[model samples]
Target: MDATAPPPLPTRGPAGSPRGGQDDAAQLQLLSVLHYVMAGFTALFSLFPVIYLVLGIAVLSGAMPVDSSTASSPGEVQLMGWVFTGLGTVFFLAMLATAGLVGYAGRCLAREQRHTLCMVAAGVCCMFMPLGTILGVFTLVTLTRTSVRQRFAHGAALPPSTH
Candidate 1:
């Protein structure tokens, strides 16, 4: 209790014990691997937006023509179709890019790098996708913290290395 003594550092686990001194590293590694696998699945499913866009364009452009009885002249129909097709293509590419970026961010996390910037970028790209933005935002939030960042990078909850 000497006044000159520096304050004790906070303990992270059981009383008078350091963290990750046992099986924690292995558990963290497994979780990291699982997170990456889930991210891969997310990336694959995100492609649906792109597929929808292509199908929409095809239908609109008369490439996959609708019932003949419902349309007037093909020329007017074709012009209208092009507009919808173009819009669909734009949205499709946007969604695809979002998914790809998020997938890449997940890979970065699994590799144990500082993924905050990448996650933020992925989240930004996913703003247009319905659930994508929400998931990306969650990932970004979790990855931005100091402890979480360290845990991800090293597959353990140890303090960051000074070297």
Candidate 2:
């Protein structure tokens, strides 16, 4: 061994390669996946209100019975049914729209495009709590990195392989 020779460069791990670019890319990818999963859940839960509206209608129509002791008059039952239906429709549409936006943001994040839009979506995700909070924070942190910003600027679909 030559003492005067420069020390060998550190070997990069599979994920830590790409001049430290892969780490950010991987984090973004994970965040994107989380957004997608959250979107699916949002969409699924949005249907619950619709189902409630349907059941309400059925009860009002007498197809499903209500106990006589607790039952309101037909007019009152009809009004309640309408209210549920209206509220359910509004909630369903709103949640579906939210899910669509999040899903679109996830796709853009995975492609390393639309940085500002992804950041906005992530911020919105932060409002949802629990899973969204985790995903949103991670997304914000990863997307704010200098390297990640450069990757977006370069419009690269994926990080270059170090091999």
Candidate 3:
């Protein structure tokens, strides 16, 4: 119990060492890992649309027949195939692109760079439901913090602390 007990250190502690950023560092590391995992899941789900693509190809190739009861002519069947193909391709490609962005954002976070990219990725991730929403919300919250923003600005990895 001494008045000279060093005044409890500044809120930011030191110049190069973030003394107060330990929590932010840990949270960023965890979020980055989660982003990578989410990216993988998104990429995996993107393949589901390939089923539609394959079915479309089959219809277009004449391997699949159209029901006379449903379609008036062969032309209608071909058009249907095109619709499926186009929609499937669009969804698949879009999801894959999103997955890539999420993964890249995660890398940026880990490296403490590209704060804008990370924020953008988080917002995009929010479009997804449930899990993605959770991750996105958490990421958005973490990135909005003052200390975290400063860390991102520094663009330097926090040194591992030895207790």
TM-score of each: 0.51, 0.74, 0.85
Question: Candidate 3: which stretches are off by over 4 Å?
Answer: 1-19, 158-163
At residue 36, what lDDT does model 1 achieve?
52
Q: Give lDDT tens digits, candidate 1, residues 82-137.
A: 76666667765665665565556555554556556556654564564555555555
TM-score of model number 1: 0.51
Worst ten-residue run, lDDT, model 1?
15-24
lDDT string for model 2 (35-151, tens) is 899899888888878886787677667787666666467667677767777777788898899899899999888889999999998988888888888888888988887778888
Using lDDT as the measure, which candidate wins? Answer: 3
lDDT of 1 at 31: 38
lDDT of each: 0.56, 0.82, 0.90
Evaluate residue 163 in candidate 3 and report its C-alpha lDDT on the 0 to 100 scale. Answer: 47
What's the lDDT of the predicted structure labeled candidate 2? 0.82
| Native RMSD of candidate 2 (Å) | 5.4
> In model 3, how large is the Cα lDDT of residue 59?
94
Query: How well does candidate 2 match the true structure in TM-score terms?
Result: 0.74
Count: clashes, candidate 2: 0
Clashing pairs in 2: none
User: Model 1 Cα displacement at 143 (Å)?
Assistant: 2.4
- CA shift of 147, model 3, Å: 0.6
